[model samples]
Target: MTKNNLVFETLPLYNKQSLEELLKNRINQLGDFSFEDDKWYYSKKNDNPLRKEDFIVNFYQVPIQYKNELKYYALLSTGLPRVIRTKCNKISQFLKFIDKTYLELTIAEITRSHVNAYEYQLRLKNSATYVKQGYYAAIQDFFMKLTDFDDTPNTVPTKNINPFRYIKEKSKRKPIPKKVIRSWDRVMKDQDIPIPLEFRTFYWLIRSFPNRISELLSMRRDCLKSFYSEYLIQIPTTKQSGGFIQEEIKTIPVAYSGHGKYVINLIQQLQEQTEELLLKNNIEEDIRTDFLFIVQQWGFKNNGDKPSVRYYDQIFHLKKHKINALFKQLAEILDFRDDLNQLIIPTSHQFRHNAVTDRAYAVGYTMEQIRRLTGHKNEVMPKHYTHQLIEKHKEIHLGIENLRSSNVSPVEFRGKIMNLDERTTKQLSRDPRRYLTWEANGKKGVGICSDITGCNPKGTSVHFECYACDWFVPKLEYLKDYKAEYEYWMDVVDRTSGDTKRAAHFENAIRNVSYLERILKICKNGIEHFKEEKLQEQLDKFNTPPVWE
Candidate 1:
């Protein structure tokens, strides 16, 4: 089949406005478009920054086969110009590693092996785990676009398409333990650093408040509002989860606390500094938005003058690099442990996790409560790894029902606990060497890093297989170990079956307690509510609880 010329009138439906605009602006400077055997041609001096360096777009209107692939790359590059630029560069690097550029590549030409090679190259460059996965996944989507177009006659090889499935990256999230919080508190309170107090406050807010970094960076001054009986700051749609946006304003609510208060104080300090600095240079309306931060150039004597809000077009990327550099410098001065490097690296999303974890401890909030605060619609936590970790712990502590149940005295429970303790100790002693090296003191002193035995090479997950590993063995052992606790859980389960109050107690215990003692405390606290069943049965105390006579 002979390829048709891609003229102004013949462009695809999705290509309408952009092609129309480009054609109008360039028709005079450029000539008619034409197609030759297996190739396409168009000539126009480029003005779009992305195309400016290339000067000309060569190749036939991307073959119908490659059009969708192009659009997929285009969709993934959706943020700011800088974001697109960075993403494009990353894509281009993959293309080069594969030895094909936009014109030279076809959907069918891409393959899983090619992706694997690119991944290997990326690993050699020491690309971070996420970066490697992101770039390759993007490339896969680029190939996917080939399937979406209106004119394509055939599909890319299905087998070669989704390289990410073969090379999924493992979870990189490091759970911040209490000690990390202590270190952050110590440094922030030192008050002797050369860093501006405002910057320090920004750092504190992110660490304390459940906010994505981009949301924090894009915070406009007006988003601040009174919430939960105190003033709270809202972070609108940022780059990560697309902060809740209203009227073109992306935002999330941050309630008042030691951290939230610090954030508010820092905003006032920066606003004053920005206003004074701008006014000194004769900049106008320094008060347009209530943004807590704005981009300014670092000229010989840079003015704090606002760049027409258009500057915010590149806000996400610019702010990310800015914040990353800031923390990196701080990491240097504090002689911060290299171990914390992964945690401290500027990421807007991690702050949201920190808030969830910190609040889960402080307020004893359930996952659902924390989820509501973080704006997660479903029960998914800030990161999958975290959710999985919590689920693992939940399985251990909350698996009381799975144990065999029969009438057993508390003494039997105590005896079983002692026996289990002895068995675990004996097992550990048998493999003491396996546990010793993994227990070295970290910055947090005998840190959770001791659990690093669980760590694996991130990227390319291994499917969980019971047939391959006996994960169920421990669950079985628990059933045999604590017969009394198991019976108690069964009782709770039966009591709560038709009773909402009892069900809530079980859920509360799962969310709030990790240790056996803590579990008892939570259950005890809810005992009053559970005991009121008879009172509830007497009559509906709709208004006032008819004087507890």
Candidate 2:
């Protein structure tokens, strides 16, 4: 993969602007600040509403040769307040590294050798590839993006190749385990859990919508809408094209039930609280200040740990670190542990991975269709995650206690055979929505109903009869249920005797037993055919363990 090839982390937008034009623009204006000065105290930007530190860049902190180049990229790359601060901070580290390497060096004097040495030092100090790559990113952007202007030397040798690709390492980020998420969901919705609405609602949004924390954190107060019968959220495409090239709005339709519905009510409550606090403080909520996360603080201030004083307790911008702190508190309460039996620290992005992977499971979705759910710039990740999910099945902790259909995936089991793969299932089914939760057979999730309408006929023996239906998908976890039902049909067949009516009823019972046996065989075939470790682990997750164990 090329540098910034992941496309999720950063967008290279300054390719259209040469180094010369940006330098001129930097001296003219960046929002309200003219960056020609030595130091800047910038607190607000037009685009992003999230709370962040001042984007103060003291050019004198870096040697003169690199100062203007840093200024050019920072100004042109972003207007988002937090990102502007991040660019300044990450690029500053690179400049500091250069200062120690050579007593004095001009920007033009810097070559690939200097960059290679810097990268070597980063690798030596940090084992994580993404962490090291992050430090080099701004510098890479500086060299790769700058164009020569007379009186300005922009001839860094590292400019030729993509900085992101140069790192040549994959991101270690993977989906958080589904079991942990289910636990988190249970805790998040509890009324007595004492999780502040700000953190709970914030996390709920991440769980419901697959997006980066940055995008959700900057969510506007007016983000929600009632589109006819459905409710949609106007998520700011904050990370689109690296948060600068073009600003777009993505509409995510929220479910009418579950946490989806709860979040809408929560947002409304937060908005009202924000309005009340603003009125009490004699402040007006404007576009810049109207945000969902920023609300009246009750328990220690939302941004920090300090208790809120009566007059001072007003809506505050919930910082990114504050959310991190909140999750740690929740994790501690839940006593969430990994396979190693170690305490697991949860993160905001963990929810996004699970959300994306779950959406990708809909076999009817194309790579392009999945991108809409992922908010990804390219279709690459939608395809990448399918294989990644199968590879990382072990790292994912699924429940062995419950035989819920959520743990069973017939689509995956079918995909093992060439003729009955996910692609083939899509071709065979007329409906775009092929999978629906089946809650019959005296259980919440016994199996999957491919066509719920066709299978459930009035007054018919639809319970065990589903085994014979073309649309019904038998879950491996429900193997015990199948056996029990088969016994019931067999008992009925043996008991019945006498005339033609009784014989016909006995024949139907025998037919039911045959269907159940066929389903049992299909489940057995799946176990034998998919002996692969990944598929086995998934099958083992929900199967009822032996009674002795």
Candidate 3:
């Protein structure tokens, strides 16, 4: 994949006439802002100067030849700060590659061979399929649009691959542990605890609902509204709301009891607190309009100044880092750690994962219902966890049915830590094998223990066993969780290697991987998805060393 070796003769000869037209359009396109400036900013109105920050991109690093053309591609494309910044940066990498390889070559000179070379470099530097796509697609997008007015619709020889969130990081997401949640629950209510009042409110609010920190940050002062017997909170979402729809409202229902009641109370308290701050006059100009959060600000110049604050800055607290930092501060205070004695730094996203898995484990929820809250436009969900409760409530109201999501009937075991319906109670008199899924009604239960007595009696390893066990009944509805688990364990299999005492770990990995594959088959296709009869026989196929090979 070199420039002179020219592997692709498919691209039509360089059309100078087309280049002139494209450059003309770009020149007119950039009239909203001066090209002389080294930095570009994003604003609701392009006329307004974007506040100087890394929220957008800095064009100062991009080379002179490709800067305007790259800007044309991005400015007309996605306007998201995080997205545009990354796209611009990746395109800059392409231009830099061109600078190194060819003499004063512009973006137009870069062809299939150059792109393949750059994509090869991406493969060397990155491992995640989606991460490579995230970088490669940017340059592809640039060329795709740059030649839009050319003779053909096809720009680069490369084709676009849709990056999948489920294939990437979502599968690895696990709910925050019950021990940690219980500890935090106790600590949050203690008046004497060192946690900030606002942070405590943030924790409770986020914990109560499956929501992102961004959605919470942009919540209106008048978000909570009572409808009939229940309450709904209006959440402004822009994560993937395309076109002229800058935002859309995603409402989550909250009944007036249990955590829902607590959540409702805490939100009112926060509103009252921030309302007092609304008296201040120095609000930041570009703060999200009528949002819930408003914090007093101090710049680098105020390092040694007194803690007294006269006004609130109305600054946007949409970024996750600040909330994550607060969580870290709390984690350190709680001295939180796992069985491995590893310290845990809980973030806002884990709560969302918990909410998703909780709903997914039960058959009452549908994929469409769950997708509403996750704030994604096309992905399977962040929505499911978001809307799981609404659908769960309907199931509880109708009473449990003999439900099935596949050929193998799923006994919807009320997950421990389950919090959807406050009305569901444990059936103490029922036999373990006879149980159908019941509502949690707010009572916590982990996924059903098939042992009828206790866990770990079979001597099975502690990781992902339920996913592989014959008693582990899976179905179509729980496919998202399975996919995530499958992707996660695959990564674990890739990382597994051992010799002496560590041989136990290898054996366990093989067992878990084989079973997960079987379970996934049962989940997707039906109960009749196997040929091998025994666990030992299934385990035989994984006996090869260099597991990745």
Candidate 4:
């Protein structure tokens, strides 16, 4: 065949759909292709030609040596169908580039300059930097595999000569802002606006649960599992691990606070609706298990049987672009605008970021705890979410330092104060001057006591609780420590929301700080400086809780 005819026959000319079908058919017919029991097998196909068209028909086919290498690499390497398809496309593109540019050049004869030229062409064709980088990496991986292939007969060793190894990949997406998240939540929950129930529930789950959009869409009726009184959803992870496409499960607990109830109710309702629909359609027992989320759409089919079912599959299952478009449409409908009045478009991944960040800061979850909730194997991603929290904590710490600069004299203590240490207690027992006279059990006894004893149970040891104890006195040196303690508690109160045990603890600490402040004011002013009622009123005003929402 002529060079032009060879190029037309060997090169991939079809669209994505046609290419996928062609490759699938080729792999199934010529290779050991088996997908039984939901498991894929390509072991025997590793050494076989992937397609007869290139091996038999095309004159300028991918050199048999490189073709076989690529076939084995594609089969042996584990990735999702989409990912594998992308890899095949990248390899085909690289091979075509070589065949067109240097017709006589063998795979071994290709060098860094030739690879660089291919990348340059890719850059011209694909405007996205990340896309260019991805294509380059895939091509590099192809060459690397050729070098590792020990059973190579006519292939060249190109593992050590990877040209695209130094190329950098830049992130084109940014994490969603907290303001947008709050606004989106508020708008979705607004009953007057009348948003779709499914969309509301979908976004609610994304906000409340740290789950990927895909995981949420893939949820089944049996996903929910009860543990004690709490509920957990077993999610099948879509990420790849090791060299094989091994499936993994991530269990996410159903939160009892915030909008957790709303999420649970929605999932339960969806599950029930799916079951009812299946029964009504008289679906077979084997095909009755349906995805949790569904919607009415044209051209919908069931179990490869007939185009009868209108709502068979999950609404957003594997439809990431559509899901993102829906979010944008929701934003438009809600009139979501940033401070500058520009349209605010939200992405599905943003919900994941918002969930992780909210848990890290507002919920006061530790990094490890956030990681567990987010299904992250390490602290890196959790840290990224908590970076803003860390900055806020630093500001709070600085505020504490500024608040602790007050100068005050130490309150005079008539009786020696005993430390909690055993040695100090022995010394207090030995010294009569350290004891305060008290009448107990019809006998005049020497013991620790003060005019005010309303703070704690009698005879109980006072430690850090001194801030709330009326008998305890403050000193100039300890004033800074008191301010620091007060500021820390206030910061915690500001970050925490809803009715949680930690929020309650922070409120209690704030109350103690108010008590300490009252005492300090009294010490600054002499006795009878102000009316008792007026002082009490002022203390009440100071202790009023600040509204967070």
Task: Say which candidate scores most in lDDT.
Answer: 2
lDDT of predicted model 2: 0.54
TM-score of 3: 0.48
* Tens-digit lDDT track of model 1 for 343-381: 444344555566655543222234454455668876544
Order of the predicted models by TM-score, top scorer first = 3, 2, 4, 1
Candidate 4 — which residues are off by over 4 angstroms? 1-61, 82-140, 143-150, 153-156, 159-169, 172-180, 190-196, 240-246, 255-258, 281-289, 297-318, 360-549
Q: Which window of ten consecutive residues has the lowest lDDT sum in model 3?
A: 300-309
Backbone collision count in every prediction? 22, 2, 18, 0
**Candidate 3, after superposition: displacement of residue 165 in Å?**
17
Relative to the true structure, candidate 1 reaches a TM of 0.39
Show pairs that collide, candidate 2: 3-164, 3-165
**What's the distance in Å from true for residue 345, model 3?**
4.6
lDDT ranking, high to low: 2, 3, 4, 1
lDDT by residue (tens digit), candidate 3, 28-56: 43334444556655433232244445345
Q: Score candidate 4 by TM-score against the native.
A: 0.45
Clashes of 2: 2
TM-score of each: 0.39, 0.46, 0.48, 0.45
User: Candidate 4: which pairs clash?
Assistant: none
Q: Once superposed on the true structure, which residue ranges of model 1 sit more than 4 Å away at CA?
A: 1-150, 154-165, 169-180, 190-195, 238-251, 254-259, 282-291, 295-318, 335-353, 359-549
**1-549 per-residue lDDT for model 4 (tens digits):** 111112112212343234334334545642354321122334332312333222221112345435645565564444544455567667777887887888867665777677668867876783566676667778756654333223321222233333334456686656566677678767767776545445566787777655678667666677777654346666655442222233345455444433454566766776776667556654433232456655433231232321122333433222456578767655665555767777778888877766654543232334444466568886444445545433443333223223222123113223323223443333233322213333222323322323221112111112223333333334332344445655665565455422233332333333444544543553444222324546999999889887872
